[model samples]
Target chain A: MSELDIGILALQGDVAENFMSTMAAMNELGIDGSVSQVKTPDQISAVDGLIIPGGESTMIGQLSMVNGAMNALKEKIGSGMPVLGICAGMILLAKNSKDRVVGSTKQPLLDVLDVEIERNSFGRQKDSFEAEVSLDAMDIPSFQGVFIRAPAVLRTGSGVETLGKFNEKIIAVKQGNILATSFHPELTRDVSLHKQFVKMVADSKS
Target chain B: MIPLSGDLPKSKGIKSESVDSINVTKGTSTLKRGFAHMLKNGVVMDVTTVEQAQIAEEAGAVSVMVLDKLPSDVRKAGGVARTASIRIIQDIMDSVTIPVMAKCRIGHVYEAKVLAEANVDMVDESEVLTPADENHHIWKWDFTTPFVNGARSLAEALRRIEEGAAMIRTKGEPGTGNVAEAVLHIKKVNDELRTIKSIYDSGDKQGLVSIAREFKVSLDLVEETAKIGRMPVVNFAAGGIATPADAAYLMSLGCDGIFVGSGIFKAEDAMERARAVVLATTFWEDADAVKEAQKMINEKQSILGLDVNNLELRMQDRGGSA
Candidate 1:
């Protein structure tokens, strides 16, 4: 396969870390793909795969909408471009955000995934935790999940497949080329999830 | 007589394919620490408007602090410098993807509570504003949102930490755009830490206890800080940092990060200067990188910095002096 280009939505939240982790994953996979930050539509359109990193969901959604990146992202995801959404990114990609305390938050959402998410499902900012997520389906032994004001999958559509969970709560979900995880995989030393996502990107490119 | 490693506290239920229950803490302090770690070597810019926040984000700021008035302007206005308007804070929060931090008057728990309710990434019990309480600071431990406070000495930093400040920044003379006071403050804290370290190294437990009594913080926290030889929480340099060189100097002095206020937006070329400051901060050790960042800005375009001595009010003097 030709070199795959991976782009991290640079609108906000751990963009540099995601880029670094993706590069590490590409190197581990022995793929010659380059990882760069993408904030413009032109940059988004050029990537073989994309990542929306964990950050403030409200800010990311509002910024993307104002700059037209959200529309561009929706089109790319619709065209089957592989993407990974972590934490706030996960909340943004979901069809609706159901805050455990506020019910449905009115923040801007991409509505790309047919899943209901509970924002800050674990608790407040002080309630965040690090846990080992079971990703048996991905053939990984165990991925250390970093949850920080992270969201959880309250419900998944029939087409969506659950890939991982933490404390009996859904933390990762997938629908075709789109993948969303509540925990921040990039924050950790482990790049296996990034490798898995890169593999998906490589497969799609072929 | 000792138990096996598997018998360690909460390690018995090691479950696969699930969040390790053992890693959960009573509070999300670990997660907050992780967040602060990610911000190392980054710049947190103070911005007033949504447009300013956008520019900060585009310029690669790790976070943008929302304030109604610049420190200089607050000093000049001479009124109660409270937190930014909630609507403005919300707008800025919505405008940028980076973390948005807002300041509350020292010891104003209600103001901090309102900010937390607004869902800011962090709250700063800042001395730059008029103190709501003369003798005490807000009990940060009561809040779920992590807090950052300013300090001039190790005692101040540890007190804030004991009260649960997730981060610390030197309380330089705000609005001056002069880095001298910040330098002095950070140096004082550093010198105190070095002194404590020597006491610990010499196995002078009595001396350590005396130091703890002087600081008025717990012995355990003091010992932990002494062992680590630094603030337990992330420490960023703030107050009067105007230029990229100023930022680089502070970072080189061992600050984890920097906070630029009135320095960027107050300049003639906000965008270029903001970007340059971020660059210099991220690459403080590299002289070439700092020089490149310096070249990005024209000195004439920089904010006219005020002399620290001439400032009528010293923010560092606010709150508990000890």
Candidate 2:
């Protein structure tokens, strides 16, 4: 596969860690991918894949809209660009969000994944936790999942395939070239999820 | 055969090493210690810019809570609030290794993700600030990064802990600048724990059932006790922490740390106040430090009048209400 350039959405939250983790995952997978930080709308065009790290979805969406990166993201994702949304990033990708306890947040959402998310269904920060999730489709037994104020995929559309679950709630889902997880895979030492996304990126490019 | 010191009453179930050792001395008191030096007695600085973070660090703060504005701003300027920028977060991370934390609106997993991506030592799901999603809680099973959450009750704290939050903090509603609510919540949790322990000690199934029944009614208390059982995980006090004494008082209540947002910067002597807060965290029981801290109080400047409170985005969920 040709060298793939990966960019982490750097507007807010977990950009650096995601960049480092993606790079590490690419290196581990023997994929020659250049990882960089993407802050502007134009930068989205330069990368083969985008990893929207975990962050406050509303802030990210609002900022991305104010900064004009939201449209760019939608356009890129529309063009079949492989993207991975972790935690808040997944909320941003969902078609709609439910249970947004703060207020009516009408930020730009990618709407790439035909799913509805219940933001903070896990109660409060004190209720945040970790567990082993079984993603049977990936042929993996279980993966260590880290959830910090995470969102759940309340309802997924027909195109989306459920990838993983914990406590009976869908935690990970993938639709075509888009992958979204309610947990932070990059936070852990585990790079398999990143590797899987990289593989998807590679497969899509091919 | 065993020495009296070895046989001295230790916290039930907690490993001898895990129980906090409190030693009282005439002039100096033995500083309380916890697992992994989790900053049990730490100072929280509400900082927006990297410069303030530096000042806080240099001033002896154990940790800093990076925000886009001081609490005063949120009260005056009503709008969507932003957290510290990536540049500032990186700058602060670069400046100090003493666990820098940032707040994300409630259920704003993306913010947590961003903080995690930034490699922030920890993130706080701040209830004092507005939430991104008004309805849902930030699901704890999502990210690998450790986070802290604010709780008003023991059940809330325990639920958060079960959700995989690395730490729990008492949610003393922010912007109020009053610590009364937090104090009450802490006391309630403690009092309920004692009651539950007594019932559990009776060693009867009926006693267990009664305790469980009580737990259902006071879910937060049960959760808090369960969280306490999970050693090494921190339960700090946050919101409305105003002075060195306040920080020290929280420590005295058995909080692992204190998250002070507007307390330091809002005061006239920002540096001096921050330094005093840091001192309080380490030497909370020391008379000299207390005396020194008392002198550092700034009566002229109050965080309430500042516009720090108006800066955050307060989105409410459609289904669930806090």
Candidate 3:
């Protein structure tokens, strides 16, 4: 059996952090896997799983749209590829999103996740902070949620299962194979989230 | 491709997967340093107006650094280079969805305050701006807003970090339209970091302590930096990067990102040059792709390269005192 290949959407933003964290998670899980940054649809297609790491959503969306990776990403996620979208990635994966300050945006979105997001819901860089989040079902006790100009889930469709919330705001959720977080799990030592996503990919491969 | 999941917008109650409410801790080290991490591997363009800010956003800049004038213009229009007007920074913030950063003259507390109160995503204690105080840099711990400072060498970089800078960029001679200085700065930092990493690997604490004393920083700073084998914060290549190749070369040198000062809007083909630089920075390892990006811009439209040798006032030398 071939080792699972997971691609981090390299359009823009913290691709290296995701690459390192995901690699560590794969190793910790005792799973043979490789992680690479994918900026093109062809690269996206080659990966068994995907992670759209946090960065500027507008930049990521614009690059993804112009490079034709947006549609490719949607196609892959729709096909039930296990995926983890973090922070700005959460904003891109939503069905609809508007900024807390600038109001609505017209940038291209993957729009596969059944949620409406509000950008900078926690405020600007000054308001960015960390939290001790607990993922009840995943047994991720005391997971540090690093929210940096992060979004908040305003609404989740009936199919969406909320995995975590902070200050009454929906911050992490899952709908089948699609997992999204409003905080940066890759920014810290906790690779449990990545490990869980990798396990999902490993299970799907089997 | 369309979304494959249920289009049913039924708002169901959460499945109680959330364990319990969490405590929010603001302005911690992770929050400060992690903010800049999001900008890694991207281009941050400097813009003076809302239009330029929009152009930067459209050109795929990770963020727009709001400046009162391009570094080139700042040089030509010399005098006291102060922080940009609050109104302009607010306007650029309103015009673009990307995070907005602005420069405060090094050691200018009030200017930094105004930029912070204006709610910019980050502040750059910039060398391009005339130093408000040559003897002192801002003690960044006073502000919750993250700050990026320019450094020409590893000691400067570590000093700024010790002073609470969340990110660092090479103090490439701004406005010169020459990347030579930026190249040299990053190379120096890389070489020093390598030295420290090896010194730490050899289990030489005394060497590290002396290194910290030389940097005028804390021993912990040097130890942690040596352990990490890189800048404690995201270090970008900044100032004078006026072309796609310039941006790519800096990225290849291991700078976390690219910051183009007068590189974009000063050119005849600002938008094309901006996009080309973004492409090159994002795919620096791909020589073929970088070549294709270079083809997007005409050399004739490029910013006139300035000979650093002829420049009398080097912006990089400012604010290095104390």
Candidate 4:
């Protein structure tokens, strides 16, 4: 059994927290894995799995492109690398994004997932809040969801599964090896979502 | 690619998470306090426009302070510096997801109210702005929004805290790009803290009382400040910090975080300088990292800094007791 290698996109966002929580999840699961911040294309290619933490999606997308991580991430994910993108990270993973306040945005996006996301669907920064969300499909009885300028999944491809919804709008989705959520799970104490991602990574390896 | 689980999560009783809108007079203090706490070990840059705010967010600034002009520009223009335009503030708010802070003229309560109405994350009762009142500072405790006040000594810091400042920063000479004033201010406050700490350790009640009287603050706040051995709130180093080494040096000096104004955008290589500053701030302890950060931008590209000694008006000398 090889130690699972995890990489976090560190161009910007909650990189450190995600790295810490992923390690914590692995430790709690009695799993041996190494997690490190990945900033370049070569680093991203070496990881068994990747997690893009919540941050400004436009900034992250631009920075990732500048560092050549965008093309690398797209190629790797296309080849079967499991990934978990939170908040702005999820926005980057979407195929399209619409800004409700501005009507449209020209910000850079990855456009991988077959989902159309509405940016700032939750509300502004002051409107950010926390609440319990159900993810019973992953055996998560109730997961604490922290939403800060979070996006909403307006529509998804037939291949995608909606894992959680807030306000009757899809906030979490999975397609193939990709798992994305509009809310930040890393901000909470529960690592059940991360544990599920780790399990998905291990199963992919076998 | 491995196929994801097809089973959808049961949407049985999950209702839309109700959002509690933040109000000015209700539960904002805790929220603002926690927000300041979240900025620990981070950097906050002064940004003038939405594009600059976007750049600051990309450079990993914990938050941005929006102003009408950079401090250096205000100094050069030699005019009354006031809060940024509400339209600019709104554009900045929409540009980034991170917190946005706006400055108010010293002792201007109405300016603070205007900023709160604009929905800024924080208000800086800044001395960089020409003092609107010569005698007193804003009664910050009256507002639910947190305020960051500038101080040059232990007395100034205590006085501001007494008036309900959520955060304290050194009143270094703004716009000069000289780190000396900031250093001196931080040192003065820190030295006084050490004296009070010794007094507390020796169980000298009279000493504590005298110190409180001299600083013109409550004995309880003074004693608690000594017991904590630092400012009761987050203390950031500001004024004229212009380089990676300058930022790293202040972090080494024990400030909680940093506030950079003219240092970044004023530079010829703003983008590289911004990234270098963030890198140096995060890796201040590592000499090699700081060295690399310094090399990111050429020395000639650095701003031509003004000497603090020749300044006609000292921004730090505005408002409040000596």
Q: What is every candidate's alpha-carbon RMSD to the true fold?
A: 8.4, 19.1, 7.2, 8.2
Model 1 residue B277 distance off true place after TM-score fit, in angstroms = 0.7
Give the alpha carbon lDDT tens digit for every residue of B1-322 in model 2: 0000111123121121211232111100000111112243455677988778868766656567888777656655677675668788777766553346787877787877788677665677776466677666676445534467777665565555545455677776565566775687677666755665565455444654555464343444343343334322456777677777887887788776677877777777788777767666555666676667767776566454322234243211111233
Q: What TM-score should be assigned to candidate 1?
A: 0.68
Q: Which candidate is the best by DockQ?
A: 3
Per-residue lDDT tens digits of candidate 1, residues A1-206? 67899999875456767887898999988889798888778889999999998766765675576558889999999999999998878898999887665465457888989999988688655456667667888888788778776788989998999998777789999999998898888767689999999999999999
> What DockQ does each prediction reach against the true complex?
0.14, 0.01, 0.47, 0.16
- CAPRI quality level assigned to candidate 2 from its DockQ score: incorrect
Error of 4 at A118 (Å): 2.3
* Cα shift from native, residue B212, model 2 (Å): 5.8
Tell how far residue B280 is off in model 2, in angstroms: 2.1
For TM-score, candidate 1 versus 3, the one ahead is 3
* lDDT for each residue of candidate 3 in B111-184, tens digit (9 for 90 to 100): 99899889998999998888888899988877778889999999999888777788899999998889999999
User: Whose lDDT is greatest here?
Assistant: 3
Please identify which of the two predictions, 1 or 4, would achieve the higher DockQ against the true structure: 4
In CAPRI terms, model 1 is classed as: incorrect
Q: Stretches of candidate 1 above 4 Å error? A: A1-132, A137-144, A149-163, A166-206, B1-27
Q: What would the TM-scores of all predictions be?
A: 0.68, 0.50, 0.93, 0.72
Candidate 1 TM-score restricted to chain A: 0.97
Better by lDDT, candidate 4 or 1 = 1
Off by over 4 Å in 2: A1-206, B1-37, B204-232, B302-322
Each model's backbone clash number = 6, 91, 0, 1
Arrange candidates by TM-score, descending. 3, 4, 1, 2
